[model samples]
Target chain A: MELSLATRTVAEHTVLEVGGEVDVYTAPRLRERLVELVDAGARNVIVDLAGVEFLDSTGLGVLVGAMKRLRVANGTFGLVCSKEPLLKIFRITALDQVFPIYSSVEAATGDGTGSGPTS
Target chain B: MATVRLSFSPAPVHVRTARLVGVAVARRAGVAEELLDEVRLAIGEACTRAVALHNQYGLADLVTVEMSDSDSYAVRVIDHAPLEASVGLTKLPPDELADESLTDDALTTGVGFALLAGFVDDLVVRPVEDGSGTEVRMVWPVQRR
Candidate 1:
C-alpha cells in the first residue's frame, strides 16, 4: 500500500501523521516530507506512527536522517509509536535509545518528562 | 514440503510483494502467529538489501526469493550484484556491530545485515557459489501438524 502523510500543528509542535506501509518503495516520500518540514523551519516535530501498519529499515533510516537533521538545526524530534511490532523494530535497532518515543501525540507534545532523546 | 518461489526485477516496488507472499507462506507453513511480524520484516529487509545491491551496480538482473517449509521455515533472497558488495557488508561478526549501529552512511546507503541479524535468530549471508552476488538466508522455527 501507498504511504499517507498529513501535517498539522498541535500544541505549537508540528505533528506529521504517517500511515500505510513504509518500505523501500515508499520511504523516499517520507524522507521528502520530513525534509520539507525541516526546510520550512519546523523546529519541534513529532512523527505520529500510530496509523502505520508496517515499517522496514529503509523507513527507519528516513526517521534517523530526519532526527539528525532536526538535531543539527538545534530542534527537537520525537516519535509517537505505541504499536508493539513497530516498537520491537526500534528496540531491536537500539533506536529506542536515540529518539524521544511517546505513546501518543499528546504525550509527545506534553511536558518534557517523556523518555529523553539521545545523541 | 511446500515451497514458494518469487523472482522479480531488482526494484524497490517488488519488495512489498515479496514480503506479503513470504508471510503468507510462513503462516500456512505453521509458523507461530507471534513471529509473523518478524518474518515479514526479515523478508522485507532481505529483499530491500538485494534490490539496493543490484541498483548500486547497475545490474538489470532479477532478484530471486524462495521460501520453503521442508524443515524449519526458511527464506532466501538472492541478488546478482558484484561480489564485493556482499564481502564488504555481509560477513561482520556480532561483536563488531556495536560500532556500526546507525552510522549516517549506513542509513543513507544500506541498513546492511546488522538489522536483519536482529530479527532472525538463524541468519546467514554468503557469496553465491559459481556466480557473483550474495545469498541471504533466514530461518525461523515452525510447528508442523
Candidate 2:
C-alpha cells in the first residue's frame, strides 16, 4: 500500500507522522524523510506511527537506521506507536528496548529530550 | 481445517496483499486478535525478503504464499530467488552473516528474517526441492498464548 507522510515541529522536535503499510515498497519514503530530517539537523525526532496499519521488518529497518543516524548526531530518537501489531513487531525484534516509544505525539514531544544535542 | 493459497509476482506491491491474506487466513482459523498481527508480520517479512532477493539477483519469478489451518496455523512463503552467491543465507554462522545479508538498499528487508525467527513459534527456511528458490515456513498455534 502507498504511504502518507506529514511532518511538523513540536517542542523543537521534528515529528514525522506516517500512515499506511510500511513494507519494502513504501519504507523508502520513510527512510528518505528521516534522512532529510537528520541532515537538516533535527536531532530530537519522534516518528509517529500511530496511523501505521502494519510494520514489517523493512519498516523496522528504516527505524533502526534512522535511530542510528540520530545517535551518531548525539540526539535522541523516539517513536509514537500504540498499534498492537506494530508493538508486537517491535517487541519481537527486541527493538522496543532500543527506542524510547511513547503512546502519543504529545507525550513524545514532552519526552524532555528536546532537539539537537543535549548535555 | 481450511487452506488458503495465494500467488503473485515477486514484487513489492504484492507483499502487503499477501500479508492481508495471511491475516485473514489466521483470523478465519480462530487465531486471536493479538496473534493475527504476528501472522501478518511473518508473512509480510517473508514476502519482502523473497521479493528483494528475486529483484537483487536479477531473477524473474513468482512468490507463492500458502496458509493451512489445521490444529495450528501454518504459513509458507515460497520464492524463486536464487541463493545469494556471496552470502548464501540459507543457514550461516552468526558471525558470518551480516544481519541476514542486509548489505545494500534492496536487501534492507533483511531484518524481516530476524523478526520472523523471533516471533513465530516454529520458523524454518529451506531450499525449494526443485532447486529453484527458497521457502520460509512459520507456524502459530491455535492455542492462544
Candidate 3:
C-alpha cells in the first residue's frame, strides 16, 4: 500500500501523520519527510502512526534514525501509536523502552513537557 | 494444509509484494489479526534479506518465498548466494543481544535477526541440500499464543 503523509505544526512541535503500510516500498517517503523537517529546523516532533496499518523494520529504521538526528540537535521526538501491530515491532526490537509511546496525538503533544526527541 | 510459493526479482520494490502474498495465505489459513501482523513483518524481513543477499553476491536469479499452512504456519526465504558469501546475519549470540537495544545505526547497518527470533515461534537456518544457497526458515503455531 502507498503511504500518505500529512504534516502540520502544533505549537513548536511538528506533527507528521502517516497513513497506509510502511514497508520497504514506502519507507523512503517517510524518511525523506523526517529529514526535511530536521533540515527546516523543526524540533519537538511527534509522529502520529494511528492511521498506519503496517510497519516493518525499514520503517522502524527510519524512525530510529530520525530520533538520533533530533537527539543530536537537542530536540524532542515521540510516537503516537496504540495499534498492537505497530506496538509489537517496538517490543520486538526493544525500542518500546527507548521511545515514549503515547496513545493519541492529543496526549503526545498535550504534555508540553519538552523532554526533547528520544524515540 | 495449504502452501503458496512465489519467486520474484531480488529488488526492494518486490519485498512488499512478497509480504502481501504471504499475509494473504496466512489470512486464509485463519491467522488471527495480531498474529497476521507478525506474519507480514516476518515475511518482509525474510524477503528483504534474501533480496539483499542476491544483490550483494551478484546473483541474477530470483529469490523464492514459500508459505505453508500445515500443523503450523511457516515461511522459507531462499537466497541463492554461496556459503562463502554468507553475511552470517543469523549468527548473533543471544548474550550479545540480551542487553542491547535497537539503535538507528545498528538497524541501518545490516540485517536484523532479533526481530525474526522475537516475532516468530521458531527460526531455523540451513544451507540448501544441493549446496546452492541458504534457506532461512521460520514458523509459528496455528493457534494463537
Candidate 4:
C-alpha cells in the first residue's frame, strides 16, 4: 500500500532500500527510480526487499527491467529478500536463478552471496 | 452454497476486497491455509488487472465482485470499463519461449494472470453479454493436492 525508497552508497555500489507493497500501481514509481539511478551512473545496485511485505508480477517486471538495464550497462543487480512467502514466489518462478539473493542487507552487501552468480 | 458479494470503486480498495473475499471463500471451503494464500493472491491479481484496465479508460466507478463457492470456489469480477482490444486473455500473444525477459524472476514472477493460471485449476475470461462490460471468472476446485 505504501512505498518508501531509500538510497545509500557503499563504495561504488548503490543500495536501494524499498519498503512497501509493490504492485501494478506502485511499480511505475519503482521503475522510474531505477531508471534514474542507472542513468546517473550507479552501476552495482542492491535492492533490499526486507521491508516489502508483498510483491506481484508488476513489481517483478520492474525489477527484471532494471536488472536487464543494469546488465546491459555491464553493472550488477542483487536482491535482499528474507521473507519466506515472498522468497517462495521468487523460487517458484525460478527468479532465484536470475537475481543473486542475500539473506540480509549486510550479507548482500557483504563478502559471500548465495544462489546467484557472484560479481 | 457459500457466497458473498462486494461492490467498490475501481480503485485500490478493489485489491483488498478481492483478497478478503478470496481468503474467506477458501477458508469456508476448508482449503489449507497455504493454498488459501495462493487463491487470495490469484484473485488479487485478477482484480488488480481489471481495475488497472478500468482506470486506464477513465472508468473509475463502482465495480461489482461476486464470490461463490459450490463444488469449486469461483470469483467473478465485473467492471463497466469499455472492453478494449488489449483486455482479454486471448489478446495476449503466445508464450514467448525464447524471450528471456519473460523467464526472468524479476520480470515474470509473482502476481499476474500467469500466476493465476499457474495457481488456479480453472480460469475463464469472457465478455459479458448485453453490451455491458468484461467478466472474469476463476475457479479453484475444492479437491487438490
Candidate 5:
C-alpha cells in the first residue's frame, strides 16, 4: 500500500528503487514516475523491486507499458526482484523473459563491477 | 461440507470482506499459503469489478458472497446489479499493443476482466435466474503448487 521511490546514478545508468505493492490503485503513480524519467532522457533504467511485497496484474501492465515506452525510444528497462512469491508470478506469466532480471540492484545497475545477470 | 455466506453493501469494503473470507476458507481447507494468496487475489478482483459496475447504475444492493468447500474450494459472488451491467471476458478487447496513448498507466494497470480470466482456473460470470443481479462463480482446485 505504501510506495517509495529512490533514484541513484550508476555509471551512465539511472536506477529507480520501487518499494510497496503495485496494484490498480498504485500503478498510476509508478507510471507517472516512469514517464518523468523517460522524459528526462533516462535511457537505461533499472527498477529495484526488492522491497515490493505484492504485484498484481495492474502492476504487471504498468511494467509492460514502461517497457514498451522505453523500447520505442531505443532504451532499456531491467528489474531486480528477489521475492519468491513475486518471482513465481512473473515466471508463471512468462514476464521473466520480457524483462531482464538481476539478483540485486547492484547487478541491475551494473555498479562499477558487480555480479552479472544470474543465468 | 462447510459453507460461509454473507451479504454486504456493494463497495470497496466488500472486496476486503471477500478476501478475508477467501483466506479463512483456504486455511480451513488446508490449502497452501501460496495458493491462498492466489485465491484471495482472484476473489478480490471479481468482487471489486462486480461492485464497481453495480454501483455505477445507482443499483445499490446487497452483495452476497458464498464460500463453499467440496472436492475443491469455490466462491460465488452475487450482486443485485443487472446482468447487462456485467462485462464479459469475450467482450473486452485485447490490450492495444500498438497505441501509445493506450499505454496510459490507468489504462494499462486497471484491473481488467482479462487479468481475472488468467488468474482463476474456473470462472463463470452470468445473470441470476431472477434477472436481478450478476453472479460470478470461481473455483479453486484443492491441489496447487
Candidate 6:
C-alpha cells in the first residue's frame, strides 16, 4: 500500500501524520518529508502513526535517522504509535528504548498527560 | 501439504504484494492469529532484503517466494543477486553485523537482515545450491486444528 504523510502544527511542535504501509517502496517519501520538515526548522517534531497498518525495518531506519538528525540540531523527536503490531516491532528492535513513543499526539506534545514512552 | 509459489520482478513495490500473499497463506495454513503480523512483517523484510540486494547489484531477474505448510508454516524468499551480497549476514549478530558494515553516516546495508532476525524465530540464510544468489528461509509454528 502507498504511504500518506501530512503535517500540522501542534503548540510548538510539528505533528506529521503517517498512514498506510511503510516498506522499502514508500519509506523514501516519508524520509523526504521528514527532511523537509527539519530543513524548514521544525525543532520538536512528532510523528502520528495511528493510521499506519504495516511497518518494516526500512521504516524504522528512517525514523531513527530523523531522530538522530533532530538530536544533532538540539531538537526533540517523538512517535505516536498505539498499534500492538507496530509496538511489537519497536520492542523487538529495542527501538522502543531509543525513540520517545506516545499513545497519542497530545501525549507527545504534552498537551494532555504526556503519558508515554509507552511500555 | 499446501504450497504456493510466487515470482515477481525485483522491485520494492512488489514486496508489499509478497507480504499480503504470505499473510493470507499463513492464515489459511492455521498460523496463529497473534503470529499473523509477524508472518507479514517477516515476509516483507525478506522480500525487501531481496529487492535491495537486486537493486544494489543491478539485477533484473525475478525474486521468488514460496510458502508451504507441512511440519510448520514456512516461507522462503530468494534473490538472484550474487552470493557475496549476503556474506556474513547470517553469521554475525544483528547489531554487530550492522556495526561492522556501517558507513560513516548511513546505517548498515544489512539492517533489514537484522530486522528479519528479530521478526522470525526460526530463520536461515544461505546461498542457493546452484551458487547463484541467497535464500532466506523462515518458519513459524502452525496451530494444528
Output the number of the TM-score-best candidate: 1
The digit string of per-residue lDDT tens for model 6 on B1-145 reads 9899999999888888899899999999999998888888889888888887888889899999999999899999999888887874642233542242344123424456556887788999988888599999999998888
> Candidate 6, residue B64: CA error in Å?
0.5
TM-scores, all candidates, are 0.90, 0.80, 0.84, 0.75, 0.71, 0.89
Model 1 residue B104 distance off true place after TM-score fit, in angstroms: 5.0
Model 6: lDDT of residue A82: 92
CAPRI verdict (incorrect, acceptable, medium, high) for model 3: acceptable
lDDT of 6 by residue, A1-119 (tens): 57899999989999999999888889999999999999999999999999999888788878877877898899999999998888877776666767788988888998655576785
DockQ, every prediction: 0.42, 0.40, 0.39, 0.30, 0.23, 0.41
lDDT of 2 by residue, B72-99 (tens): 8898888886655314443222332224
Q: Model 2: which residue pairs collide?
A: none
Model 3 misplaced regions, further than 4 Å? A111-119, B30-34, B84-111, B143-145
- Candidate 3 chain B least-lDDT 10 residues: B91-100
The TM-score that candidate 5 achieves is: 0.71
DockQ-superior candidate, 4 or 6? 6
Candidate 5 wrongly placed segments (more than 4 Å): A111-119, B1-17, B51-64, B79-119, B132-134, B141-145
Off by over 4 Å in 1: A113-119, B90-105, B108-112
lDDT of 4 by residue, B1-145 (tens): 8688887778764576567766886788767666876777777777777777677678867777788877777788777767673244421233331145554332332336556676667777677775757777887667544
lDDT string, candidate 1, B1-145, tens digits: 7779999998889999999999999999999999998899889988888898888889999999999998899998999888887765643332332243546446533344556887899999888885898899999999988
Q: Provide the interface RMSD of candidate 6 in angstroms, 1 decimal place.
A: 4.0
CAPRI-style grade of the A/B interface in model 1: acceptable
Better of 3 and 5 by TM-score: 3
lDDT of 5 by residue, B1-145 (tens): 7899977777654566567777898778766666777777777767766666666767778778888878788889887876666644332233343246654333432434555676777988888888588788988767534
Can you give the lDDT of residue B5 in candidate 5? Answer: 90
lDDT of each: 0.83, 0.75, 0.78, 0.72, 0.72, 0.83
Candidate 4 CAPRI grade? acceptable
Q: DockQ for model 1?
A: 0.42
Clashes of 3: 4
